[model samples]
Target: MTNYNELTVPEATLIQKQLRDNIKVTPYNGPLNYIAGADISFNKFSTTVYAGIVVLEFPSLKPVGYSLVKKEVLFPYVPGFLAFREVPALMDAWTQLPVKPDILVVDGHGIAHPRRMGIATHFGVLTQQPTIGSAKKKLFGNYEEPGPEKGNYSPLTDRQGELLGYALRSKNKVKPIFVSPGHLVDVPGSLDILLRCIKGYRLPEPTRLAHNAVNQFRLNEISEGWTSLL
Candidate 1:
């Protein structure tokens, strides 16, 4: 495992470059038994981080299991280096999963980043798993606002005119969500899966469930652990 906190910005940037080569941007064609969402939460200026991963049954989107980890994160919340602060705890939760999901939906950017190494992309590379980034705001790239209808999307492109992801309206009249491929998946493929995971909300089921779960866990004062709902 990488010493996430011990590295300087330059070292982290280099690591990102090396890991970029490991990313295989292909269409998602794996098993559909399960899909997971990961999220991290903490109070303002607090080092106590709460990380959660919620696994749902494919197609049904029903929760089957979850893992939680609370740790003191020393890394500051840098806009681009969020994975350095969160992935360590997220991976701790990942290891405790009795059964791993076929894909992960992370609440951050993916390849749609300045260095092509967003939290989703970073985590996917570490685990060698297919992951998608479902962010609520734009981090990198430009696109026209999508139509104010469910499932409408506009192409997101970089300055070089290279396709990055899509700005999708998951629900009618709601703000668009940025969908991007993290690793082992392409731009369209990422959006395709996110469309299926939507449940009439701004955020998709997998990530929404996680976002809610982690916040609740923190509120309830839960500790680091894993639970099986299967």
Candidate 2:
């Protein structure tokens, strides 16, 4: 793994371009038994980052295992460089998870970025897992807004007309979310998994659960006055 904080902005951008060449969009061929979601939150006025992971049984979407880790934020927020800021802590949280998932769903982009090295793709490479990105908003690519009905989707494509992701409507009459393959997963597989994971919500269960868990952990830390200079 690259030492994200050690690299300057220009170096990081170059690394992303190189990493994009390594991304594989093959579909996951193994049994879809377990799926995981990952998210991160920050403590107020501090560089403290709280990362959370939730593993759920496939189809049922019932939470079977979860983990959280708090660590000093290592990278500053930069557009198109979110993985550098959040992935290290998420890796810590992933280590604490009791059950390893067959597939991971992240709360960010996959190939739907300028260089196609979104947080989900970055994590997938390091973990060597089939992963998908289900982001609340589009970060790159051009697409028509998906229809309001549930499951409606429009292909998100780059200027060259290569598919990058999809504008997916996870719920009826609600705004669409962006779905993209991270690694070892194809675009169709990504959308299928996300739709199955949806439970009357705009976000899929895995990411929704992870988002809730990380925010709760951050709230607890703040309330308990946990602080470090870092």
Candidate 3:
């Protein structure tokens, strides 16, 4: 078990090193009948966090199961150690999921980080599930701009020229998203999944739905609390 509370930056870095070794980048030939997306959002002007998981039936991309959990922020926001700040709350929501997804898509980076371990990797390792990192921005690495067409991609490479992920064009004439294997999945698999999940949006359906879910939940909670106080 990994410690999730009261750790220094050095300790966190050490843990990341151990967790990075456990990540497996391979193709998942198993049936992906169900896919899920996990994401977290913070309350406005507060440290309270809402984590959400949205499951969608694969190929068809229909909604199946969803879960959300709220937690007081425990860890501070650190540049490379975002997992510590967010994963705990995400786990709270993940445990409430009734249907375990065949693969997970996280709204963050994977190996495309300074430490080769990101929030997506942490979630995948803890859950022991195949996970993909589909990030809105590039956290690290350099890559040429992908072609201005949906499904086109360019390799994202580290300073050492090792390929870490891809800059994927999910929509035509739009900025690309960064993608990498979190665990139990490879670059090719990641690309395939992302392209399938995209439905004419900058983000995939699973993640976009989850993002909406958590935000709506937060709004409802805050509104209800305010009304009760009136």
Per-residue CA lDDT of candidate 3, range 70-134, in tens?
Answer: 88876788888899988988887777776688998998998788988988888898889898998
The best candidate by TM-score is: 1
Per-residue lDDT tens digits for candidate 2, residues 1-230, read 56677878898899888777789999778999989899988866788888888888898998876788888876798889999999998888877765679999999999899988999998898888889998988889999988889889999999999998899988998889999999989988888888899899998999998898788888884322221211
TM-score of 2: 0.92
After superposing all C-alphas onto the true structure, candidate 3 shows an RMSD in angstroms of: 4.5
Instruction: Output the lDDT of residue 34, model 2.
Output: 87
What CA root-mean-square deviation does each model show from the true structure? 1.2, 4.6, 4.5
- Regions more than 4 Å wrong, model 3: 1-3, 221-230
The worst-scoring run of ten residues by lDDT in candidate 3 lies at: 221-230
Candidate 2 backbone collisions, by pair: none
TM-score of predicted structure 3: 0.92
Tell me the whole-model lDDT of each prediction, alpha carbons only: 0.90, 0.86, 0.85
User: Pairs clashing in candidate 3?
Assistant: none
True lDDT of residue 83, candidate 3? 93
For each of the candidates, give the backbone clash count: 0, 0, 0
Higher-ranked by lDDT: 1 or 2: 1
